[model samples]
Target chain A: MKQVWVFAEHQAGQWTSVTGELLVAARNIADQLNGELNVIVCGDQVEELAATLKQWKVDRVYLSQHPELNFYHPLVYTETIVDLVSEYGCPEMILFGATYLGRDLAPAIAARLGTGCAADCCDLKLDENGNLLQIVPGLGGTIFATIVTPFHRPQVATVKPGMLETLGSSENEDKAKALKPVEVVKVEPRFPQNTAAIQLHSVKQKPAKESGLQAAKRIVAGGAGISGPEGWSLLEELADVLGAAVGATRPAVDEGWASHDLMIGQSGKTVRPELYLGIGISGDMMHTIGIKGKGTLIAINQDPKAAIFKQVDYGIVADYRSILPVLIEEVKRREG
Target chain B: MQPLQIAICVKPVPDPKESTQLQINPTTKTLVRKGIPLVINPMDRNALEAGVKLKEANGGKVTVFSMSPPEGELTMLETLALGADEAILLSDLIFAGGDTLATARVLAAGIKAQGNWDLVICGAESFDGGTAQVGAQLAVLLGTPWITRVSHLKRVDDKHLLVTVEDEVEQRELLVQLPVVLTVESVVNQARPLSLWGIVEARNKKITVYNADTLKLDQKGIGLDGSPTQTRDLFAPDASREAEILTGDSPQQIANQLLDKIGWSRKGAAN
Candidate 1:
């Protein structure tokens, strides 16, 4: 039987949402291919995580416990997984969350195994021949391309968060009964003899600040129409009043007006806030694809005929510079 | 100061703004480019800028390498105008339709043919391919350490470099030695515009073209037939979100109406 594997990612013992998201995708693909779903979690002391995986639809859990893996090392992580794949006769397909670790490790592992890997894929499915079809946005999300690894064994792809919904049994079930029973297996840790070649001196950490774009319920995003760097401050003021995060289009980022982390697009982060307010931004497909919010969309642009109006729940035809201050006042007045 | 020898991999892609003109070949699964104009891929320009600045700071030679069609030589000349000392184009019909892995193989071969390479650089990802695989694959092929999305070169000496890279969550500063492959991030440095004088100087520079045979790569694993991955199909995505445009007289009224539509109450979220 074909085997489907997901490289479950975690940090400091907590599971990342992308891991659950990939589980959903792997489950569907496994069902379609009549394959067994397996998950590999490598970290220091991953017993709790392995136990949690037992409740999911996973059939096997490969846990590699080691101190060196507490934090992800590119060479160490890639070598650990690559060794497992070779020992298990190689799975039919492997999926990874398009997070930093996944992005760094997927290509290297594929290279070591002499296979092909598709990166930042949004969709996956099994073709009639049971080959994996990887769909990714190309040309900055202007067009979508369907990639297939016909000749390569164990086709690999990395999917971004919020792109796929998590799937399993109903939410009412207890943890163990949530899905199928899983067999947990422990694997010996592997390491290069001379690991000192790539020395990891220290990991300087940013303050524990979650990006507003990722955690906020509402987001006020801007684009080139904001004029220049000075415009972002105004948007920031409005976002503060609304208790929302500040997001920007690709142009705003490329122009150096906004930092890259604030960008919302195909090449940037995907967001699903309850309310997405875009001002002075044309609704380019590149930006729109990243916006998968369940709430209302309000597009404010001077061009009444702007493409953004076509995809908005509320369209304000006026200069955002004129509208922002007024909107901030109204929201503040309502708050009072 | 020891002279630095750098090899940069560049790809020529259709102007992303004119992406509306891009088409796909149903049979070959490759891009159909006939009338579309091409330019150096956006991020590759950043890599080139990094290379140029490195050479300028420390006396060295920066060579631009690309595996593309014969027309790519024009783009390489433009790169020379951007500050590369010389340019090499690996072109042949045999190299057409190669995926990232196949593309990286030819690049590794090209970089190997030129002896005494201290560093190799590439863009984090191409705007067209969006795979971001070649640099990592090339690093594996070259048997060297690699880093991607490098935002800045904090310090550089003859044998090592201290670089900062942006990750999904935070910024990480790494101390890596030379004989490394670096895929630079977009925000590393602003790519300087081509100067008129630089363009004139490029007229005297040499652009060496090499066919697949010149690299002496195993012919069986070099091109479309050898590419492990294939395209099943290419098509536009299904439109998922259809929005309704709201009409209001004043900005305040629009804000109030929007707040109501989303069911935001004074107390908290009401949805």
Candidate 2:
């Protein structure tokens, strides 16, 4: 039977949302190919994580536990996955979330396995020959390209987070409980002698600024049209009034008006907020691709012909500076 | 502490500012990159700057390497202008159409032929491919420890370095031994602007061109034949969502209409 694998990425003893997203994508591929879906969990004490996989739509879970595996060591993790594949023979495909750890691990494993790895793919589909088609944005996010590993056995891809949907937790829990328990396999992890060359001395949590773009319900974004620091501060004010997170176009970030973490586009965060207000955005596909959420999009631009107008639910043709204060006042009046 | 030896790998990518002009050859399923000018991949400048700064502080040499067609010579010269001690271009017809793995293999061969070095640096990813794989793959091929997305780096001693790596949620500080590969983030340092004297000096610097024969690379393992990934199809995405233009006699009127339409009131506030 064909075999498909998903790397279950977890941090701080909780599964990242992308792990659930990967499972959803992997489950579809497994059903289509009549393959067994397997989940791989590697960490210091991840038996509970492995057991939790029984409630997922998977056939088996492979757990590799070691003290050194607590934190992600690139070489050791890559070696563990490569050894597992070698022991069980190569599978048809493997999927990973395009997180920092996933991006680092997938490529290293692909190099060791002598296979192809498509990074930050937005979608995955099977071709007529059952080969995985890795869909990614290209040419500065102006086009979509389907990449294939025609001759490689184990197709590897790191999928972008928030691009795929997952089953609601309540619905999934009920359905999964009716299915048979997934088998768990334990593997012994081996490390290379040179692993000591890179030693992690400390890990510090990033300051919690601009942290919730992925899960935010409302977002207010700015583009080059916002012009300077004053305009950016105004944008922050509007976001604060609306209880929205601040977002920016690549140009705005390039202009040093916002941090890169607040960038929304093909190369940055993919946001699916309930409502998105874009001020002075020209709406390049690179930025629009990240905003295809089910939301009420409103754009304010001086140019009636701005590309952003065509993609929004409501567009006001005026200079954003003229419209912002009026809108902020009207919102406050309604609150009063 | 002896002076360090550093090697930096760079790529000449199509200028991202000219992205609107980039097109796909429908029949060949490839990018039609004739008119677009090439620039050193943006982040690679950070890597080059990091290397140059390290050399400037510690008194050493920094070499730059790239794998591209002959057209890439201009980009290599730009690196020399930005303070690379020397540059090497591994260009040949046989090395065309390679993916990340093949690219890393050819780079590994090129760097290996140049003898041993204390450190190798690269941009975390390229703007065009955006795969972010070659550095790690190159490190694997060279048999060295590798770190990606290094935001801060300092020389602790001749044999050790202190580096900070950033991911999505946290920053990790690592103490790494010498003879390592580092793929740096753009935030590591601002790349220095080119000076007139640097350009003049660059004109006199040596840019060695090495081909497959000089590098002694295997015929079947350095190009399209060796690359595992291939493009099956390419096309623009459908983005034809027609928006409703909100019009009114004045700004206040339009604001009120927009608010009412979206049901933004005290009772229905988003928060």
Candidate 3:
């Protein structure tokens, strides 16, 4: 039988939402191809996490646990997956969330396997021949390109997170009860004793208060029109009032007003929030493609003909400087 | 300590500022790059800058490598102007239209033919492709340890270096031995501007050209034939949603209307 594999990603001892999202996406492909849906979960003491995959419509869970697997080591992790593929026959397809780890690991694995990998794919489809068609925004996000590895087996793709829906808990429970018990395949991890090439000295976590842009319910984003640092502060204040996360365009990041992590665009994070407010942004498709959610998009720009206005649900053709303070006060007044 | 041998890999990408002008040719199923001038991928400048700085601080030679068409030699000259002691351009018809894996294979051959090196540096990702795959794949082919999204670096001793890498939720500090591959983030350093003197000196700098025959790469492993992935189709995204522009007498009035449309009230705030 055909096999479809999803690499379950977890961090800080919690299963990332993208892991569930991948499982949901892979399930569709598995069903269409009449294949078994499998998940590979690698970590230290992650038996509980691996077992939970059974409830999420997976046919099997391949667990590789070791002390060295706690944190993601590029070489070790790639070697582990390569060994699995070698032991078991190559699956028809392998999917990963386009997170930092996925971006780092997928290509390495593809190179080792002498195959191809599509990066930051937004959609996956099956061709007539059962090839995985990796869809991604291309030509500065003006077009969608369908990439395919026609002659190669085990077509690989790193899908963008937050762009797909996950199976809900109730749906998962019902499916688990209907399906047969999931098979658990435990594999031992082997590593060379000489890891002195790279030694982990310390890990400092980011402040927990700053939530990821992908998970934010509302996001207040800035662009080049956010002329300087003072402009970012104003946007941040509005975000604080609305309990929203702050996002930025590539230009804003280039101007050094925002960090790269908060950038929302084709090359940065893909966000699907409930509401997205873009201030001083021109709304290049390169930036707009990342806003995949069907949320109310509002743009505040001084130019009446700005392209961003065309893409947004609401546009204010006035200087953000003139409108921000008034809007901030109105929001606070209505709340108080 | 002896000076380090630093090798930097760079690519010439379409100018990102002019991205709106970029288009895909439906017939060819490829990007139309006729008029857009090519510049060094932005983050690769950080990689180049890091190499130059390392050479400036310690006594070392910085060699730049690029796999591009003949037009890329001009971009290589710019690298020479930026303080790379020498540059190598891997250009040939057989080397065109390769994916990241194929591209890495050509680069690995070029680097191997160049002899011993202590370090290899690349931009975390390219501006055009943005695959961020070459550095790690090159490391695998070269049999060296690799780190991506490196934000900081410092030499600890003759054989060890301290590297800071940006992870998903944390920054990791690692101690790595020499002869490592590193893909640096744009925040690693500010690239120095080109100088008139540097431009004049670049004319004297060496830029050696290598081809498939020169590198002795196996047939069916260097270009389009070697590429595993192919573009099957391309189409513009659906842009049918016309925005409803908010009009009002004043900013306050407009704000209230927007809030009303979005169904935002103090008592009903989803937050």
Which one is best on DockQ?
Answer: 2
Candidate ranking (lDDT, best to worst): 2, 3, 1
Clashing pairs in 3: none
Give the residue spans of candidate 3 off by over 4 A.
A170-181, A192-194, A209-216, A229-245, A259-261, A302-305, A325-336, B248-253, B264-271
lDDT string for model 1 (B1-271, tens) is: 5778999999998887787687777788788876788899999999999988888987799999999898788899999999999898999999999887888889998889877798898999888877888888888888887888788874456888887875555567777878789999878899999899999999999899877888998876678888877777778656554556556887777777767787766755555
Candidate 2 is graded, for docking, as medium
lDDT of 2 by residue, B1-271 (tens): 6788899999999998887787777865666778789999999999999999999888888999999999999999999999999999999988887888899998999899888799999999998888899999898889888998888999998899999987767889999998999999998999999899999999988999999999989876678777888888887777566778889998899999999888898855642
**TM-score of chain B only, all predictions?**
0.89, 0.91, 0.91
- Model 1 C-alpha lDDT versus the unseen true structure: 0.82
Number of backbone collisions per candidate, in order? 0, 0, 0
Q: Against the true structure, whose lDDT is highest?
A: 2
Q: Between candidates 1 and 3, which one is better according to TM-score?
A: 3
- Assess each prediction's global lDDT (C-alpha) against the native: 0.82, 0.88, 0.86
Task: List model 3 lDDT by residue over A1-336, tens digit each.
Answer: 999999999988877777888888898999999999988889999987677777777998888999888878888888888888988779997899888889888988888888899988887888888999899876576678889998887788898876677667787877777666678899877574445688899999976644478788899999999899998999999998887899999899989999878989777778878889999988777788889767778888989888887788888888888788888888898788
**DockQ (Cα-based) for each candidate:** 0.47, 0.67, 0.61
Winner of 1 and 2 under DockQ:
2
- Arrange candidates by DockQ, highest first: which order? 2, 3, 1
Please give the distance, in angstroms, between residue A264's alpha carbon in candidate 1 and its true position after superposition: 1.9
Q: Residue A48, candidate 2: how far off, in angstroms?
A: 0.9
Clashing pairs in 1: none
